[model samples]
Target: MKYFFFFLFCLLIGIISLTAQSLHFGYDISGNQELRILQYDDDSQSIPLPLNPEPVIIIPVPDGPIMYTATNGLEIYPNPVETELIIKWDTQIANLLVKIELSAYNAKLIEEVKFRASDQKAVLSMSQRPSGVYYVKIYCSDGRIINHSIIKK
Candidate 1:
């Protein structure tokens, strides 16, 4: 009987794959071990399958620098920095207090600077730092946070 149910479940999964829908399998957290199916119309959402299914979890891996920008008038360059890095913001945010933080890939704080955007620019010297991956976070007085990735060469 157990084998029959297993075969039936396999057949059911085969049929479900024929349709344009998504199947999410999960167990009930209350120890019920109930099977749940979630269907989605689009393929935007996905869950990585375990390699062996032995209670293994999948994690997102980074291939390269994870960079993100939130401000339009702000610029940081040149990436893969050699010695110095420059940050600039337009006059639109000139009156806001600006704070820049440079950190290592492990999220260790390296350096920080605070100034008014009216200064038009700020320079961070990376000449003394070793070549590696780093991150920069910007905090604005108006509650805006920006992030960028930097590579030291």
Candidate 2:
């Protein structure tokens, strides 16, 4: 009986797939900040299925330098972000410690991430957190410190 129900559920999903749409996010594999997109058809006979109708991005990823280093410079964009945030440096960094501090009327420690710098760029997701001013500090193994302020909404 359980197997029968499971089969029926999958069958229903398959029927729904005919009308569902699929979305694909483009990532730069060459380590450069270039965006390209490729999609598959629903009739694909592969073991793992792909997006049904293929996703169409209304906004395109603008071209620019994707990587940076701490020595050359440090920068943060779109000050306030919900899901993800990008950090760029101009020089090669070794040990990178990222600290996010929240300060509005008062300052408080929110989160901290210690990572080895790679590819000159890093993305952080902040789906959680309140709207306000955030201080992101980057500390390198060479004893250099860089800071950027972000606002979350």
Candidate 3:
């Protein structure tokens, strides 16, 4: 008789254990899965949160914005000069072809620099030209030209 009662008790214990579930506070033990559960104190169980608010799901891929400008200004530094001069410009140009031509009585090319349309600035090097009166011609890709007279002491 005692042996029959023991067998029934073991069977009941197994059934209870098979029905009970192991839970986690903030995470899930299952691998390769992401679970977000919400618990209510009134109910002694947990339920999954809404997967996504919108019924028709759509996700956007991140992408960068477009950037471009044009150039319309120039700056020549340190008049009454020396061996070298620094040239800068205020530009609102985008993806432009730039050429800086230095000329005197007999025109000679001084320096040339190139910039992408996105870059509106450049630094020119002119350390080798002799001290004399010179002309700087700035040419744009769109057939626009600017000229300036500079003196080197």
Candidate 4:
């Protein structure tokens, strides 16, 4: 009976821990002076910031011919997106104006949107767009500009 109780206790603890959410911590290097924590709803994959002393996380330059970086705390995910694309940034710039431009490979402008930085995240729908390579340009009110290439399938 004691062994059974011990097993039940351990099982309960394991279940609780397994259901707990995980947080990712990283420093916002965009002169925002903010700490960003990323939370995911699902457990299929998680990319945590490296456990290092440096507060900034430097993403490797993309293999494409053109690459651009605007300070830090800027993240675009699910490269080669299917239907939707997510753009995330630090909350510190939430009050500033952010301009996002989407263009085709031939420099044909597709869509443009402007919003306050506080939104932090933007979900772009590509359902109507054709499957091809597109360019994303982010113009921040703080004189910061970032360019990235994305593929839609």
For TM-score, the strongest prediction is 1
RMSD of 3: 17.1
Question: Candidate 1: lDDT of 50?
Answer: 47
1 versus 4: better lDDT goes to: 1
Tens-digit lDDT string for candidate 4 (1-153): 999999999999988776665675555667543343445557665655444446578876434332444556677778898988888888655554358888999989988965556678888888788899999887756666678999998
Give the TM-score (vs. native) of candidate 4.
0.50
Cα TM-score per model: 0.52, 0.41, 0.41, 0.50
Q: Residue 125 error for model 1, in Å?
A: 0.4
lDDT-superior candidate, 1 or 2: 1
- In order of TM-score, best first, we have 1, 4, 2, 3
lDDT of 4: 0.73
For candidate 2, write residues 49-148 as lDDT tens digits: 3435555779653443233344456656656688777775554343344442333335466556534465556677677766766777665544445556
Clashing pairs in 4: 94-117, 94-118
Model 1 alpha-carbon miss at residue 122, Å: 0.5
Winning model by lDDT: 1
Worst 10 residues of 1 by lDDT: 61-70
